[model samples]
Target: MKSILNRRNVALSGGPSRLLAVAHDAATQRTAAASDAAAHDPHAASASGSPADSVVEIESRAEPAAGATLPGEGASGPRPVSTLHAVPVMPAHLNGRPVQIADGAAFEALRAADELTTFRVYRCFAYTVSLFFHPPTLGYFVALHQESVLWRALKANDLDAAGSAFHLMQEQATRLADGETRRAQLVAQNAELARLIEESETQAERLRVDLQRHSEQEQTVTGRQHQVRKEVAQLEAQRIAAQAQLNKAHRALHQLKVATSEGVPHLHAR
Candidate 1:
């Protein structure tokens, strides 16, 4: 009887243990399934409850095709980029030279200003400042402005505005360079034109001198022609006087011959 009781207690305890093992196994399996389901369902971990499905959302947000300006975007007004009113404090040696700033400070300052204005200021300063030593400050300012504009545009759901801002920044830089190049070309062209004009004037002066010399030569020729005509007239007058003297001499000779003939016949007869 004692042995039978012990056997029955052992059987009952073994049954509960088997049942518990089965329950634990089922619970573990269920937990694994739930984990698998959660893994498959991407929305499970997302804040918006649904995971981004499209390739675009997975990569980057979509932008509008046509370039358009959204409302309340970019610089406040169409004002020119401002100048650097004050330089940050630096060591005595770097006071007058380009000064480097902490990236954080530069970024904060750029973020506080208008995006367009900030970009303009950066560009303006970049033109005047050396970027090598001041790379941190310049890079920070550019990144800050870019992020601010991008964030603002995205928040407002204004893709066009964001694109426009980016394009405007690029265009403004290009235009500035173009303007400088054009000005230089204009200056060179003006100088060339001035030089050409001077050369033309010089040539004209030389031509004028040649013309004046030619005119003098013409006058001299005219005077020589007049003297030649006067000489011709004097020679014609002398020829006419010589012809008259010859005629008178011929007449006297004829008279003398006739008188001689008549006197010879009279003397012979005497």
Candidate 2:
């Protein structure tokens, strides 16, 4: 009976040891599979950590506004802006047409016309003074008037009128100078004529006295007549020379009058 009881206890203990070994092998296999899964999946936590740690990391990555700075971004700073006011522009006129005088041509035209008008008025005043103070200065007044006309035409930008007026004024000045020269020559001739008349009177008186003395003394009458004839001849020659000079002066005067009449009627008539 003792041997049978020992056999039964040994069989039960052996069976329990085998079951414990199998359970330990199965637990090891499960633990190895869990480790493999965790290694494959990046979202999976380690055996030592909980799921809450992974949640916190995900939230930190998504919510980047939590005291995190992005690349190439900065806070606000100061900048500048303009506050100056702009100026206004004025317009100008050309001919009879109204236009903006912005460019060179338009500005030049406007400025030239304004300056020309002022010059014209000043010239007219000068001419008026010349006319009143000096009548012989009519030639200068006429010239100034003609120049005013030319500048007026230039102010209007008319080249043709200005050229024609300039030519006319030059002709007038020439005529005036010619007239003055001829008048001076005539006055010189008149003086020469007066001198000749005085010389002829003196020669006549001398001849009369010689004739009377010869009549009183017949012995020397022939010599006295010869001397008187010689004196008369010299006086006649001087008178002829004076007449010739007078005639030449008259001819020059006539020619100048004709030229003046044709060239400048205004000054000549004045």
Candidate 3:
């Protein structure tokens, strides 16, 4: 067995350091190249200058070197790194947005506002067994989350702090989900209220139309009544005039009869 294949390294450090992840796709090519190189060059079979059994280098620096390939990264080149307070934990993207990690009062604001990520990079170690045969394409596999003390603890290998951050993340996720559900409920309620208002307005419009129709009918009936009363009054006046004419004729006939009778008696006496 090749000593390179047989041996492996796990790295840890106290205090503060940054975590760099290996890219998955380029990981396979590096080992195969080493194996091919050994097969071609007899001198390369010694494995003296070979990488230190996939050991990740941990060292103190104020900030990570830009575009620096992690030791043993080979063709994968420099690993990408982000800043965390003292201990480093990169952030993950959620809902297509990269989570932001702010330090000091800004991070406090995120904690108070509850707009932070829950994911943490607790451990960055080779999965072993399989790494000897078939290493994952990416050399370093870890996590990213924003503005978490728990993340720093995880980086420093603090088990208790990591656990606390895990629980807090779960709670925040629950709260956000509940808030979204409540908003949906309120929207449905508003729609229902608007529908009811529209129905009431429609009913009111129908009532107004009926009232107007009734008013027009009442006006027609009132006009008809006035016409009928006027006709009655005119008829009554004609009837009174006819009565007066009849009385005048009756008086004339009575006077003429009396005059004829007196004249006939006078003739007889003569």
Please name the candidate that would achieve the greatest TM-score relative to the true structure: 1
Q: Residue 74 of candidate 3: its Cα lDDT? A: 38
Error of 2 at 183 (Å): 2.7
List RMSD in Å for every model shown: 24.4, 40.3, 24.5
Instruction: After superposing candidate 1 on the true structure, give the runs of residues whose Cα lies further than 4 Å from its correct spot.
Output: 1-170, 253-270
lDDT of 3 by residue, 57-117 (tens): 2112111432343354535655458775786665644333333332345434544565444
Please rank every candidate by TM-score, starting with the best.
1, 3, 2
lDDT of 1 at 4: 30
Q: What are the Cα lDDT values of the candidates?
A: 0.46, 0.46, 0.46
Off by over 4 Å in 2: 1-167, 177-179, 219-270
Candidate 1 has which clashing residue pairs, if any? none
Question: lDDT score of model 2?
Answer: 0.46
For model 2, residues 185-267, the per-residue Cα lDDT tens digits are: 89999999999999999999999999887777885777788989999999999999999999999999999999888976465
- My TM-score estimates for the predictions, one after another, are 0.34, 0.22, 0.30
- Given candidate 3, what's the lDDT at residue 226? 99
